[model samples]
Target: MGERLIVIEHEAEAGLGCFAGRLEAAGVEAEVVRPYKGEPVPGRAPAGLLVLGGAAAAWDDEGYGWLPATRDLIARAVDEGVPTLGICLGAQLMTMACGGTVERGDAGLEIGLGEIEPLPEAAADPLLSALPSGPVRAIQYHYDAMTTLPEGAVRLATGARYANQAYRLGDRAWAVQFHPEATPEIFASWTGGGDLPPERAGELNAQVEAAGDELRRTWGKFAEAFAAQLTRR
Candidate 1:
């Protein structure tokens, strides 16, 4: 059926920069749509769905005034067995749809580069089978976290603040709480027009580069696993 991947990004500039390219290398066409500005959510046609991280939250989707229907559509896509990779807010939304809990973390922010320990279950899933065993580098930028996992979901990766940094539902559906595909260009876009300070920019850039390195080291494992799952029985 010539499958494709739809990336539900929150902002135009902050879409799947490196992740899209990786998907292309894996023989999948990737398209991006920002729902925060009323971008249309496509139906059950994509080979997979990769929802991106954003400055917004699962609760703040209503504040953006463009998430309810979008999330519903994502939920439907996952139920129909579209390979899904939810990052940050997208991850939180998946949790909400699968009947989990999303709450502001009292543990403060997950800023800059952080570590993720892949669970044993992750080693068994097609989405994470060949991925790094533990403590992979990831870009972190949120204060909210998913406290509960969705029904029938298996925790894939975790860290100090969030124990469920990554999850999988069956072999085809997956969600990663961190940005495994964040690239330098995408990182620049997200940091655009912000008065955050030059020093912080350097720090953030370093973190982004570190995240990219981790992906470079590990995405082939994930890509192979995912594509194999797509062609599975």
Candidate 2:
């Protein structure tokens, strides 16, 4: 049977966009599982688990009651040796699952573009090591951030406001605060109000125009990273 990629989508339109497309381009079967819609509980594990970015917090109120259970699902996936990746809210959930705490960070609203600095030890990480120096121009959209690092997790990358931008737990599980898969639709839907300056509209428009190409190149790196985990199997 072909390998399966488990994706837990939290929001209505916050599903993986370019990330999913890139996986398909690589001939990898990517299956999206909508847990919030009462989809099947992520069972039997999978080759990997990708938690997409979302506005909803993992620890939200009764509106998202399935969140706590989703944590169990992610932990189970990790326990089963399935490489997992959590983005944005997914990253926070992963941190909490790994015994880390997530609280309202003082970073305030981290929107628009941002820079990330990889830790020294990250040069040895399988996935992170593949990345080069200098800042990776990725779209950052999040109100909450991780306050503590998860046990056995090394900080892969950090930014000015978000210290825990990227992290790796054990050998396979990973989480990133920024959205590498943020397409124009995803970006626009998540953005609003005077939170971000309106002057960035032109810049945002350009990014949207080049979304296809950007997604291809960026997701290529992500797929390469994920593929490394499968090779170890």
lDDT of each: 0.72, 0.75
Give the alpha carbon lDDT tens digit for every residue of 85-195 in model 1: 787888888888778899998787776677788887776676776775666776677789899888898888889877888888765678788776666666666555574
Error of 1 at 78 (Å): 2.4
For model 2, the stretches where C-alpha displacement exceeds 4 angstroms are 192-216
TM-score of each: 0.87, 0.87
Residue range 154-230, candidate 2, lDDT tens digits: 88898988788999888788998988777666677665444456667557646655654654565468667775575
Residue pairs clashing, model 2: none
